[model samples]
Target chain A: MKKSSKKTGIALLLILAGVGVLILKGVSDTGVYYRTVSEVLIDSSLLEERGVRISGEVEGGTITYDQQELKLIFVVRDLEEVEKTMKVVYIGIKPDAFDADV
Target chain B: MVTLGNLSQSAAFMCSLLAMVLLLTGLMRNDLRFIEAGRRALTGVAVFASMAAFSLARLFMTDNFQVEYVASYSDRALPIFYKATSFWAGQKGSLLFWAWVLSIHVAMVAFNTRKETTRKNTPYIYLVLAAIVSFFFLLLITVSSPFEPLAYVPKDGNGLNPMLQNPGMIFHPPTLFLGYIGFTIPFAYAIASLISGKVDPDWLKKTRRWNILSWIFLTIGIILGGQWAYVELGWGGFWAWDPVENASFIPWLISTAFIHTSIIQERRNIMKVWNMSLIVLTFLTCIFGTYLVRSGILQSVHDFGATGLGGYFLVFMIVTAVGSIILIAESYGDLRTAHSLESLVSRESTFLFNNVILLAIAFSTFFGTIFPLISEVITGNKLTVGEPFFNMVNTPLFLLLLAITGLCPLISWRKASINNLKQNFMYPFGLASAGGGVMFGFGIREFYPLMAFTLSLFVSATIVLEFIGGARARKKLTGEPILLAFPKVIWKLRRRYGGYIVHFGVVLVVVGITGSTAFKLEKETTLQRGEVMNIGDYTLQYKDFNSFQDRNRTVYAATIGVVKDGKAMGDMFTERRYYINAKQPTTEVSVRMSLKEDLYLTMPMIGKNDEITIKAAVNPLLVWGWIGGTFMVVGGIMAIIPSRRRRLAV
Candidate 1:
């Protein structure tokens, strides 16, 4: 009984170790920095050569799209700090929920 | 004057509260009369909740703009079917629907267990279920009542969200809610067992069918939600790893673990503590998922706008968590297992590993879903973990799970000898390797796809081998034809074979997801009239543009002609709709589905220069996912059906 329990413990330890390694690798590989417009504006260098998603409200009537080139240029202002604004250039179809308020 | 809807809603809430009080008193005082009264009051709760739900449906059907819920989600121009389904399109109505379903389930449990033999655990079950039902009732009566009236009735109501007008929305929320509410039964039983100090396998046995039913509903609900996103959301793919999607998926992972671990408890009289904690965790995740979606703590397309009910949910979650831990800690001595693992390579060990992997996936998904909040609170930097994180983390884990699924049934219980493993695995292993080799020859060279295809093939071969070997043994023993013996074997071992069939279905689904994700081809182009764009053996030509009007929306449709390999296929028309009352524009994608692949088309925009921008994708093996989902549901149903063997054993 003791031998079998030891075996089980070793197996579990190995599995847990594998899981730990995978999780560490996964977190570093695909974690996206989420920033607000004001946060990004405060330190723009934080996003250098890294993928990030920023949450902000679109400035009304400041959105333009070039259908031929598939380019969308929009100005988004911080929800908490309305004075801070950023211009985003995206090249894809807009999401269905895209709006000035969102 | 109070409306019938208002009266019925209020009555349901009060009845649930009274029933909860009676049940709690009965459990505390060990009084059968109060327990009986509480059980009877549960019936009243069900009846009144149904009345409230029907009344809301009636309001929607009659286009009663006086009621806020009906007014917000329905308009005169909405179809009758959509109007009926709009019952769950908003927060208040969905909560009412959830409570109604929970009350009905509780009432059914009460009626089914009225026998004297099952009376011991009845009071605790009643207390747990009643407490849960009353929480929903509290929410209904206090913050988000569906029967709230508009101060002044408008002539017309704002229409339903245009994105929700599809057929998928009609079934998705209720199916998922059925799953979410269905877990309350097993959860109540688990807690009751702990509280009543009956930590035997009886509660597990009693709630087995309920557990399976909830699992099946959750599986179908998740698939249906993905299908809705794929077709209705105009995204080229399904399963974006969104927060709302993870909310549904997290409970599914925990429940899956619960189901498998409970099997160990039943078969070996082991892992009783593990089983109890898993059920508790499953129930907690379900409620936590609801809270996450409702509280808007995480931004998701599917969240109900932030409401006051978040505090109530948080308190309830904390109380339940603390209460469960205390009860379980006290009952730990009674919950000890008589049997332990005899070998590291045994069926029990396989199941344990499977549980670990499933829970690991759930943890990572839950963490990723809430990472932004965690980062914001801790480091003051919000960090979003996107699809890449989930796909990267989970794909290898799922592959491991599939390998275990292939290996578990072949391994003997308690201990498996090398000879036993060799005898079962040699042929399936060889066949899978050969299949992989053939695919490699066909130039399928990417690492993950190749691994996915190989693992899927391996699992499928294992299932087929199990069936064939069982049928052959049955034929030899019973002196019957192999084809006839197959059905007889399945009939005799329904639960075992039914699980094998579900695994087979999972194999198919994995294959479909792998093929669609890895081999999919997409092309986006702006084309003038009569101009052609070719992609993946199909040529699409911009034929014409047309416009039409319906009562609710103006639809601008673009007709595109399709020709594949010198043969002309039918014209596909995609629409850009402008809903009048909702003041929203929604894209209606056009898809031509076949056994091989789906040719999907969507028009993002129509330019002023008469150029149409079209996005076309060829998604391979997509239909197999739905087909496999059907197989899974059928297998689950077959497993739940009481076989003659079980009945005779009982």
Candidate 2:
């Protein structure tokens, strides 16, 4: 019984190590920093050369899509500070919930 | 006169309480009369619950705005089908629907176990099931009652959510509920065994079919939900690692692990404690999944409005967890394995590895789903774990699982010799390598996709080899033709072969996912009339735009002409619809599906200058996922059906 459990324990430990390595690699490679528009505006350098997802409200009537270039340019207003706005340019299909005030 | 709906609700609530009391008394005093009375009360609960569900359906169909649930979820403009399905659209009605389904299972259990021999565990099963039903009844009758009448009737009612107006909604929720509620039966049986001190294989024999049924439903439910998200949400991707989706998936992962491990328990009378705890966890996850959807503690696209039921569900979860732990701890001495591992590389160890990987996946999913809450509570910052996290972490683990799926069948039970291993794996390994070479020659360059395809080929080869070897053996034994012997051998070993087919189906699904994710091409372009966008060998020309108003919504559709290899094929229309009553807009995607690939197009927005912004994707091998799901369900059913040999033995 002792020998068998020791074998099982070693197997489990090896598996756990493998999982740990995968998780570390996964988190480092693909993890995105999530921030609000105000946070990004406060420190724009925080997102330099890194992928970040910023949540904000789409300013009404300020959306334009250049069909020829497939470029979408819109103004996103900060929810907390409604007077501050940022011009965002995206080159993809709009999400279904993109129209909502985030 | 009291309305039949109200009366039925009250009666269902009362009967569930009475059944709980009687069953508890019967379990405590060892009395048969009280147990029988409890069984009758369970039947009463089922009847009243069904009546209550039907009454709600009738109210929705007849546009009875006097009821708050009907007023909130249905209107005269709603179709009759959605009106009927609206029986589970909201919290109140969904709770009642849950109770109704639970009562049906209880009544079936009561009726089927009427024999004296089966009565040993029936009272405890009754107690567990009744306790669950009583909780739902308590929630329904006090907090969220579908039968509650509105104080004032409005001229018209609010319609169903525009996103839920699709045909998928009609079947998705009920099938998912069927799966979610189905876990309760096996759980009740597990608890019954623990309480009765009869931790034998008999309980497993009685509950095996229920476990399979629940797993199948969950598999179907998750697939249907993915399909719905793919088509309705207008995102090119199907799975987004959403919280609500994870909530459903966690339970599925646990239950899947339980199902496999229980086989060991049934065969070797081992893993008894593990099986019981896994079932308990699965049941808890089911309730937790429901709680996550209804409580709105986590923000998700699929969540309903938040309610006060979070506290109730949390309390119930804690109590059940504590109680189950104590019970299992008390029964630890009786639940030891009759046999232990003989070798590390045997089928038993393989199963253990599989269970570990499955539980690890479940743990990661649970962690990722709650990371935002955890981060906020600790660091005061919300952290979101997106698809990349899930895909990155789970891909290698899934690949390992797929590899094991091919290897487990070839390995011997107690021990396997190196020669036996080589004899089984040599051919499949060679074929897989050759197949990988061919795929690489054909321009499959990505590491993950190549690995997924190669591993899938290996698994498929293993399945084919097994089938061929089995058939040849049967032919030699019976003097039958190989083709005839193949099916005969499969029928003779239905459970084993059916599992192989299910594994093959998983291979197909993995192939589909890897192909679609790695090789898919997406283009977002704006085109004027008579202008064309070229992608691969296909060209999409903007032809015309049209707008029309129906009773419910106004649709703006863009017609795009499809041209393949310089030849005009046809036109596909994609639309953006604005629902008038719901004051919401939804994208209606257009998909041209084929065996090789799907051409998916959606018009997310139109420019002010009359130019259309279109998103197009060519997703390869996507159809195989649905086909694989179908095969999995069919194989599950095949496994469920008892064989002639077993029948004769019985």
Candidate 3:
């Protein structure tokens, strides 16, 4: 083998080792935190115990806020027409248009 | 507001149709008159498209609720400046804006090349470009017309998305579109060269500045988007590995690699095939990225609404990919590398390695992005490929890329001695070690951050060493001070020195990102009036709550007093405004910023009585990301300035 080929072989081995190590590390579930409301509704007990996130549109006339404590209470509707509302209690600052969506 | 509902749309459509028809006739008959007619039609298209866009903007600024786009994006309450910015805040308007930009760019290319000679096959190129333009213009008129009138125009319409109201929107879309559509010019040129059997280096030289212009715009656009996210998105971070964000970044990486590789071709007549392929791939990625973001193929905060154009884009991408490969294969003889690699340690080999790694990263990202769609298609399972997948695949590769960035500048063009390489790299290595030791002493023990901080230090050290070496050499030879000598060195070799500055800026950005991400602190608390919450070293006291009604919005605000080290700093008032007519709730984040960190607070929820809870984030060194981005923009501009010797480089 040529001298350059030997050097490239070494580099390739090192890169391959790195890739192997990374793959062996396995995939973490933290990357994708997406779940539809319908999916969560089917298995509420599975996720309700964990600090997981669920997203849906806020039901009209169901959102209440306390400016002093910076707490928001709302009901997120599963379907646009149906009144299947899930109560959401968040202790954080709300986006400006959150109330306007209602 | 100027009215352009039907007439201008028809004019745009007709002009594009006429251009395409003329191009086809010219290609078929090999007639110069038909080609000239095609060129004139392109100019007419430019005029009509610009008028349509300008009229749309005027309607937005004047608060013309009669226009559906304006009614949807702007309200009577918005200031004229923000109203103007709402031009690209939504789907229909942004697409129209994109079409307008493309028309202008295409027209400019046609007008500038009027005096040039084509190698008997330029009509084919014009035909391709004209056909592409017609597709967008027709799409604009048919599906997503910005000029369509609202059937039942209420007293007011829904306002622009509050997230897009920042100043970043004004510059981000234009700069990105400039970069995105600008590549089409060079891609068309490549196709023309391939068809005309002219495989000369002149095409590359001719499009050199155009390449740089697009690259620069892409850089600025990415930076602007990051800045907007950091300041506006209350997320306390810049890059979130969102699908839409990655789409823009992938093209940038490939284009940057191409930029570096093209230098060898221009200098030594090597890597001809690689340059051509890079241009084509970069253009395709740009188009694909636009489709990804605008087509709603992925669920992202940054993505727009779904449209029928998704399938159209998929078909178009397939056709372009297959057609380009066929063209390359047919011209296989001309596509070979003009020079062979002599040594693995040479600059050429390093560039090749960089290209391989960049392309790997691109492919990996592309796979991750489209995997969900593939999964849905194959298994009928809608799974999300999120931040975890990207961080797993891309982070390590980018870290290696950072190391390569340090090494590429030191390696000789053909070959270099080990001693010489060691001598060049020693100082930077020492600086990086010292930086890592400092970080370790400061209580940072995380593995990835530690490596990133060390690599960033190494990259910065290399850039500094490069500048000092060049300036010292010039100073010794020309009797100039280091400060005065630096600009002269830059002027002498704009690409070399300006690129080093850009690298330095990149180092700063990576450092800022690492610091903010790894060292960020956040907490959630519920506090009553006159009650205080402690997070990190700052004390936040809930002071007052106010509710009021304005002409357009109902405002609910929280007045929180921020105290650092038990000393009163300032009061930050966060608000949640409800636009009454549009029935949209928008958030306004309040922040206290310094050079070292930002105290970002957002009012996500307000209670019925007086209690409240705020999401406050302490993000460190985030401002430097914006500063670094600005530096990069400056460096790109400096690099493009025409020197005394190369007047046509611009």
Q: Clashing residue pairs, candidate 1?
A: none
Per-residue C-alpha lDDT of model 3 across residues B383-435, encoded as one tens digit per residue: 45666667877778878888888888888888878998989889989889988
- Residue by residue across B492-570, what tens digits does model 2's lDDT show? 8988788888888898899788878988999888777778898767999999999999777899999999998999989
lDDT score of residue B160 within candidate 1 = 89
Highest TM-score model number: 1
Off by over 4 Å in 2: A2-5, A33-91, A100-102, B116-118, B608-610, B644-650
Better of 2 and 3 by lDDT: 2
Candidate 1 or 3, higher DockQ?
Answer: 1
Model 1, span B556-649: residue lDDT tens: 9999999999899989999999998755588898999887999999998888857888999999998888788888888888889886543543
- Candidate 1 versus truth, CA RMSD in Å, comes to 2.1
Off by over 4 Å in 1: A99-101, B24-29, B644-650
Interface DockQ per candidate = 0.69, 0.49, 0.32
Query: After superposition, which runs of candidate 3 have C-alpha atoms over 4 Å from their true positions?
Result: A1-102, B1-5, B27-33, B118-125, B481-483, B549-551, B582-584, B645-650
Computed on alpha carbons, the lDDT of every model, listed in order, comes to 0.88, 0.85, 0.78
- Top of the candidates by DockQ: 1
